[model samples]
Target: MLPEVPTEGRIPFLDLTIPIHWENHAILMFGIWFVLVPFAIMVVRFGKGKPTTYGIPRGTPKWAFPEVCWALHFYGLYTAILLALAGAGFAMLLTGGFSGSLHAWFGVGTIGLGVLQIISAQFRGSHGGRKAPTSDPDDRTTWGGDHFDMTPQRWWFEAWHKTAGYFALFLAGGAVATGLSQFWVLGIAIALAVVVIGGLITAVVLQGRGYNHDTYLSVYGTHPDHPFNRRRFAQMLEEKDRKP
Candidate 1:
């Protein structure tokens, strides 16, 4: 089990070079971005593999973007744009343009972006928990949706979620690095810890479910709905071969 966090007090080993004055805001933003956002992504990626997993339908495009590919491309793009704008403000602050007005604008804008991240993550997770009919109009499959699972949907879905989890390291690493340099390391630390903890938990859960990496890859080796794709199909075949 993960160690129980003591209270809301400061974490140990705060030796990173950040100033404590801006601690709360920095940590708060990092939490929403690093933890909340990726959790939504994992939910969408993993739960959407089946028609009724989580709550999304079999054909739901929970993990898809623009009704086509991975949803990350869409949200990540929007997030990058917002952060770039914030970075511009940061540059202004760093380069003699930080008037009281400028500081107010950038600070408010940064917090607003953080708020947006949390909201978007919430919406994404909610989308994954969809227990709706497959034939619903909204259940239309896009390109990626079509590829969601033809074979053992759960197997590939787990792989996809884990891959996404690994990919998160890059974004979280950058958040930590940039935040630390700007004297806001606590935020990144929290975000990184969340990512690590979440991934390990999911991995353990999958093992409990009797999934291993090789079995996972084989399920998605080609069309998703083949022999390895459908658990029911595999079990039924096994039953059929047994003599009466």
Candidate 2:
């Protein structure tokens, strides 16, 4: 037999009940974490342009196609975090407080990591490059942004943000699994399976087709004189020297 819908608690102002709140929370979190967040990550990962400056000129607006990938990732994650907080707040209010359950912990951890992702992004430093608005394409001296130079700050930020984002998604999956155990929603379960499998397959196909261009090269082009590229090339030469 299916589990009965929870209808005990009443909404604060309106005539709605706890089940409505629960459903809303579930839908919001599911859509944010499973659908929207995954799509954003995938787009940013595979939607970057080729590592050539032919089509994308210097000082192209950040809202353009290839650059827009970062914009989409930025806004999508911000929106997800905000909606997640709202959904979590609603759930907490309906339940009176945190119940210390495994699901509750998973939910809290996921939301916490989402918040950290936003906070870390703020410290990702500047985007100095030949393509930056502040940079002069002909003046290599002006292209000194943290990302362009691959400074320690930017490197650490990328390391934490990318890894933690994936970890947060893993926690979200745990939350969803535990939530399903409590709510027994067949629809949500099926949706989870479909979204996870579909996202994996799509990511694999895009990667196979060489859509996953290097982020640095995509944004700054393949100019060997670029600081990061220069450093990378030097490192490769050093490694080759050491291989003897």
Q: Supply every candidate's count of residue pairs whose N, Cα or C atoms clash at under 3 angstroms.
A: 11, 0
Off by over 4 Å in 2: 1-6, 10-21, 53-56
Per residue, candidate 1 scores C-alpha lDDT tens digits across 6-101 of 112332345333222345445544555555555544444443232211222235364552233246534654564365446544434333354344
Query: For candidate 2, what is the lDDT?
Result: 0.84
Task: Give the C-alpha miss distance for residue 114 in model 1, angstroms.
Answer: 14
Q: In candidate 1, what residue range of length 10 has the lowest lDDT sum?
A: 1-10
Candidate 1 global CA lDDT score = 0.44
For each candidate, the alpha-carbon lDDT, in order, equals 0.44, 0.84
> Compared to the true structure, candidate 2 yields what TM-score?
0.92
Per TM-score, the best of the predicted structures is 2
